[model samples]
Target: MCGIVGLISADGPERLASRVAAMNAAIVHRGPDDAGVHLAPGVGLAMRRLSIIDLSTGHQPMTTADGVALVFNGEIYNYRSLRAELETRGYAFRTQSDTEVILNLYHAEGMAAFARLHGMFAIAIHDQRRDELILVRDQIGIKPLYIARHEGELLFASEIKAILATLPCRPAIDPQGLWDYLSLRFMAPDRTIWAGIGKLGPGQILRRKLCSGDQSIETFWQADLTPGPFDIGRDYAREFADQFVAAVDSHIVAADVPVGAFLSGGLDSGAIVAAASELGHRAFHTFSISGDGAGGDDELPLARAVARRFGTTHHEIRMARSDYFDTLDDVVRAFDEPYGDATGAALYLLSQRASDHVKVALSGEGSDELLLGYTRAADLATLAKVERRYGPMPRPLLKLAARFVSPDRASIFRAMAEGGPGAYRRGMAAHIGWTISDAEKAAFWRGPDMVPSFDLVQGWYGLPDTAHPLAQSQQADFGTWLVEDLLMKADKMAMAASLETRVPFLHLPLVEWCQNTPMEARIGPPGQFRTKAVLRDYVATRLPDAVLNAPKRGFPLPIFPWFAERLRDAGGYVPISREFHNWISLEGLKPIVARACRNERRALEQLWGIAMFDRWCAVYAD
Candidate 1:
């Protein structure tokens, strides 16, 4: 993995280098081992490398013989195959790096190359001869890329902060982006934390010709949800197991570095470890984390079991309360946004320690979203069916009941009444978006009228009308939450530790095949989280029974008590930043906080989210 920055400007190459260097510097934690820059007439490309593949020889800002420059972040698991294809086409390679393959492949295929790639990547390619610069992100949006067009320049980077570093002034908060976060704890793939700077959505590309100053942005691919006949009666478990092995094998292949797995002891990561070990020649290196005194089901023991089963060398990191508090600043800084996923703190620390032992690690992210794993998917599906029948409670009634009723019920009612798009948004907000209500959202923002996050999801990429309840939920998240929240956390936290984390479940062929599979095999009953039903069946015999049956507690953090204690110590609304002080209203949540402290423990997620946003602003909003 790496930090990549590119600028399309009329400015001199010397001036552009300094700006791109600063942008690259802001995200140095992403790639601290090596740094390089390439300058064309008016375009500049820069990258900081972590040296994952071809460790001794792969220095990026890698180029073709005739001077087409490429700066890429994330891995191209299928690079070996792509390189072989190019070799047959009479292309010569100078380094054993995917960077060289991508550079040459783009030269061979141009825009068509994205379709052939099969891994997570944010690519910046500058064609000096054509005088055009293009920035592309992977089809699954597993890697993030941000773009800004200002003063006759198109600026792009792996992280938004890198783009921000080149700017003269801090960009204003995008109100829509804030609402997107308030409603979902993440911006839509199309929105960034800042107003003017836009995020390049998944499966999309931005091509800017420096000569004409004409830029074209469009999607190159999408989730192939086209309906097709699938048979569940067949031995799907074995088929899925075979596919799992293939994906894990591809993700774990490294030239000089030891590839490892983040053994969460969950169904997915554990399966990834098993597949990596069984399919590859290398022994697995596994890592896990625990809280020192904050008590809960420590996954260390379960991870140890998996490690023993796989014959992998295992390491664990334990974090105390102070460690959690101390890392909050760094956590938010790493994300470059107010990411409220509390698990990120733990993952950040785990990655920090894990990086000490290895450079690349395989994670089992993206499986739940693909396989209908999130309990919310089943719940939303039920709500969708019910909405079709009785419809939802009236809006005014739901609004009136907002305080008396749970935020979840209010959101359910809102979705039932609105139907279609609102269902997923309401369900997601109630569960993961800190359960903030519409009324609370109204009070949270003090800018232009806010857009509901669902509108963006629906507009940008909603499921087909033929998609089932489970499929609807999965596809919606596949576009929004999976990209913005889950994958964002996975990428940033791992990169923050200068570790390259690859997700086997996110492999495109696997995703496409699974998405087209029968919904019965994908999910169980509503809200039960029988996600990846077939997938689990596939790996059932491979992983320990303990891991298979253990309840799906993902990166379980005792976050509520921590936030509650902090709140009691403060005696009021905790301020995260000047913006948090100014824009986010406490009037609506005051009673909720008191009620939470008394009996309603679930309300503390919002408090925790507020504290997280505060820490982010404390670091970046300046």
Candidate 2:
């Protein structure tokens, strides 16, 4: 709903408001309607409001009479109920604002109140009573919060660019973060590309004391994927349909502003549009993206089919190869970090088009993670089983085999052959088409040898609670990729257009049910695997067979040819664009670009990730 920034400083309160003001200026695109700041002693808090809930009086930096101040971003779908409960307990609200509800809730329940909030948010509370600054990210990381430190001062913001605006100088790049971005296309949740700056992970809370300058971070909630018993005879498809409809309705009705949705021809978005129509919210806006030359994969016609079925206003943003190139700089600037995937650009343009008609849009993002939707789930399960049977393919053999294959197959072979603590991470990197190997890394890294990229998913991969390969893979993504990469992309891209995006599938009750249920309800037995089987079953009658039976066509853009052409025109190798470019040797990227120019699509995918990183360095490495 807004962009937030603040700091607890060692230096006295001189210019505290001005310093926080400058930080707020960096992310004005996130909140263009209203702005406010509160200063007390060594603490300063500020927010720019987009005004989704109570348009007239939802101004932020809201404070209670006892001197507790708060600035919040994102919406609380259950706030009206919470406010009614508080009113019965003798708490009189001054305005019809969720911000006031949060302020009062904190006065009543302390930190325990955060667990009761059933919505996406990044909140900062200045409780002078305890001299504490408490920061909380939502249960699924639907919102983002980044923190940085200089001297003894602590700063937090909704985006990294705001923190960078307040810094004395540019922070050094964290080598491991770069390695993770190159290998996995996103930074891990615990660290950003900058060494001293970090982000709060999903379901996490941080407490910092102003007087003593002490801090601690802890997880408040996480997905529990331990194998549990469920009745095999129960009608789970009907149960999922009912719950999903309720969740979508809850998201649609929460806003005072008009709510729209992102419609694709695929199963997830189609189901959301069907649910919204069934719930009687008709004539609402829906947005989709179309590529000029993308054949068979274009979902625009299918989106039009859904729109006609539902009687909704449909808008399609037509993009060409030139549009992809034109938006490259803006996409890098929007994320404020290195991000590689092409689908994010689609969402960015779609949200921009939707923003002209609606302030909040519902997206079906977390369904794939909740249910066993991705084909990679099956591939990973097969790899795990093969690893148990074959123990590992030897490193020298993998190295020798790499020469005979293209970069894409070489990464998969390395993943199949790798063992030890980082095996799962290596396989996941290959799953996403990262072609870099340890041998290649040694040749590319100009300084000391890079650490194993497996550390990127350590502690998140191979959780001890579940032994099922499918459950383990889902849990790993729930912890790492779901929060760190996918959710970050959704938040940044949507917020860039001053629009709020809510993921109905991530509603806590729905997520809990999917996580606790047996995997058989999602994907069937090993011999009869079906991706997102329950979801497909639920939407069987509501959608057309063409949509119901189509394979997963994820926001296809002609980016491979685009990346190949650019790299080829740049003479088949582009140098890292950072001010300090001694880390990665340009000579090592020659083979990848050469393969891409030869029309190896996977090689171009790897280069796309590298190109995004290089663009990020050019923007931020000053």
Candidate 3:
């Protein structure tokens, strides 16, 4: 519920304080309620507080008598229990803030204490006793943290912009990070768009020995993707329902302020609202975004239906095509890193509306990746089976036949004939909607080096070979796409509005259970092929019949029509900013723009991706 920044440098305390103040100023939107700075010789810790847990006395950078100091950005749901345990151990607390709980827990257990936390956080702890600085991100990366070292200074911050604020100059663009963004629309957790900066992955810890200036990073948690034995008679629906409701309760109650939710037409958001209602949590606010019929489902009616069912105060934000263009630059600037997802713009607007009513809002973000919610999972599984049956066929013939297919289907057809690592790479590329093929990439990409989507995590595709394809896809996405793209978007867009958004589905307990769920339960029967069958079954009675079976329309934005309109407005040419002149090929983008102007959907999508990247360069690179 705040933004944290710190530096371990050789600068004098005055210079350190001044630079840290500038960093804090850069992220005032993240924590407008309060701000604090702490400097100790060679180290400085700073934070901008949103003031959710302890408004009056939770001022930080909180320090101990022994000189251990902490600046934290996030809420710890299990703090109350941890506080009671610490108090039993004779540890005295001066405030009821979760920040104090973490500081005390660190005192008692050291690094092991982080494993016991059950919330989203990015923490910076300066241990004068150990003469080390420790930085930790939450288990699922629901919060964000960036780290960079330049000219003998070690810096960490909640957002990249904060780190950039302390920099003497803009860092060069990392080509691999840009390629990853172009291939997948987001960089991996370990990488950022800037060359020298690094992002802490989920469940990761980075420690710097202030004395020697040595640094090390390690992961403290990982998804248990290993499938468990299925007991057909165990009533998984009821079990999932119990834990899910408990998670909803946990997230909704953690904040002292009123909590609201994002309720789209999709089941994920709808189920969150239903769970809150069933638990007798009444009068809480809910928010949703409806389209102006540019494209995608008009989610307002379904959202209104759930609101009426729960009798909660519901707010709706309507988005038009013009809104996308108007706020495109703001959304790009908010990310700092180049991000191409248009849905972020929608969420940005929605979060602004929610901020009028509540400081914190809950959304069902991690459920789809945890459970098998997207059709791509089933499609990939089916593709694997088909590939196995067609393994012996001539590869070149299939490649030739692929040329006969439409541009959209060509890559998928080509991917179907390849097997092993190559197949997974191409399949993943297609899964993430990569509009540029390997052949196409070779033609136009002038960047340093391009990374395929599957290579985002070295040797990730080789793991858990015995798991079902569905399980593999689910696990892969949980690590890469979910943390990097979806959760990152959620954090940046919501924070841009100064609204703290929580994801109940990403609760560690629920995530662990869902990750180990049987493949058959995640996707429905063989012929019906429904996604997220377990979730639907769990909410069958709790949600309205219409919502129970509603087809999933993922935070869809009318990017296709929007891109076409943008191209038409620009006289059928993609506007390439001078910032990207040396990075991407205008000659290579010509055909894509031409196709977009003709209203080709995939071409339009690709154009949207490039256009967003252009805007990002204009904002950040310029």
Candidate 4:
């Protein structure tokens, strides 16, 4: 709900304060309501407040009676309960803000207090008593925290742009980070497009000791998927219904200002609206977006269906192709890094529309990750089985058959033939298959050391030292893609519009609980047909079967076709300019561009990637 920045140095206070002030100013959009700066001998803390709670008295850079100051950037939804507990222990609070509760909680319980709270946050706590600084990101990383160290000083911010403002030198682009972006569309945690700036991984707490110049960072929570067999007879449907309702109810009450939901007409968003309606908040505000062109338009009709069902105030925004083209520069700049998700366009527009009516909106983000909602999961599982069965087949015959099959069929067969957890791991890497030829890949890729998506997958599999393959993949996502990519996108885009996006499904306890539930209970009968079975059962208990059984429609956007038609006419495709040629081979991209113009879908994906890279270079490489 805010932007937090700070500078810690062994140098003079005035110099650091000036730099910190500049960094805070860069992110004023994140917290236009209020701004505060505190400068001490070796530390400076700056905060921009959105005034979500305790608006009148919640001015921050808040300190305890003992002089430990805290600058926080998100909501601790359970702050009231933590406050009550702290009050019993003789910790007197001067304000009702969650920021005060967090300060006191750290004072009373030390680092262990983190486990007792539930919410999304990125906090910078300066303990003057110990001459130490602690930075903690939320369990699921709904908030972003970036850190950089140069010349015996540490700079941290809620956005990379803030840190960029403080540093005198140009940002260093890491080749590995760029490679990751090209291969997967986004950079991974512990790595940013900038070489020196790093993201604090989710569920991680980092402590920097001033005297020794020492830092220690570690994960405090992880998903544990060791569920026993499913028992449908135990009234699980009813229990899930009750828990779902309670979870939605609690999240709805967390905001201090007028709140609404991102009603996308999908079951996830629809179910949330339906639940909120049943809770007696009759007048709910909802928002949705539709693409401008014929093929790019989405399921706004379905969104309307849910809105009408609940009788809520629904607002719709129609985005023309020209609108997307116009905003491309701002969107890339807003991200401050190369992001490949085409949905970024839709999300940015949606958040902008939502901001007009409400200060905060609930989104259905984490449900798919927690519940194995994507078809890729089932495909990978099936492919693993096939690989095991065909291990002894002749390689030449396998290759011949692969050549004859369609790309989708070949990919599944190849994945299955590869077999084992490692193979399955590689299969799930985002953007694993090449839409471009090997020649094009070689030409387009400028980095000497390219990391295969498999390596990232393998690295994730080894993160927790656990035996659960499914859980390992999920945990890897929790650490890498979920936080670094999806959540990062959500925070940046939403904050860019000065809107607070709250995801009830991403609640820490709820995510942890879902992780422990059996996969069989979550992913139903074969073929990805009955996925999110557990969630469906829960919804069935609250509403009619019609609503529960509604087809799963993800936040769909027509990016592939949009890039081909709309962007094509508007000089959206980057020409073979010298700057682009420095990294990617123009000779390699030319054919791909030609094919994309010919309406080749696969070619368009590659063209879009190049176009995005070109656009990003134009923004950040100056």
Between prediction 3 and prediction 4, the one with superior lDDT is: 3
What is the lDDT for 324 in model 1?
Answer: 86
Query: Pairs clashing in candidate 3?
Result: none
Q: What's the distance in Å from true for residue 82, model 1?
A: 1.8
What is the clash count of model 4?
Answer: 2
In terms of lDDT, the poorest run of 10 residues in model 2 is 424-433
Minimal lDDT window, size 10, model 1: 425-434
TM-score for candidate 3: 0.92
Local error of candidate 4 at residue 88 (angstroms): 1.4
Better of 2 and 3 by TM-score: 3
| Alpha-carbon lDDT, every model | 0.76, 0.81, 0.81, 0.75
Per-residue lDDT of 312 in model 1 = 88
Candidate 3 lDDT over residue span 144-180, tens digit each = 9998989888988999999999899999998877776
TM-score of each: 0.90, 0.91, 0.92, 0.90
Candidate 1 residues 31-50, lDDT tens each?
A: 88999998878888899998
The lDDT of model 4 is 0.75
lDDT of 3 at 372: 71
Off by over 4 Å in 2: 376-435, 525-527, 576-580
Can you list the residue pairs that collide in candidate 1? Answer: 373-531, 392-417, 576-614
Quantify how close model 4 is to the true structure by its C-alpha RMSD in Å.
4.1
Q: Assess the local accuracy of residue 171 in candidate 1 as a C-alpha lDDT between 0 and 100.
A: 87
Model 2: lDDT of residue 338: 87
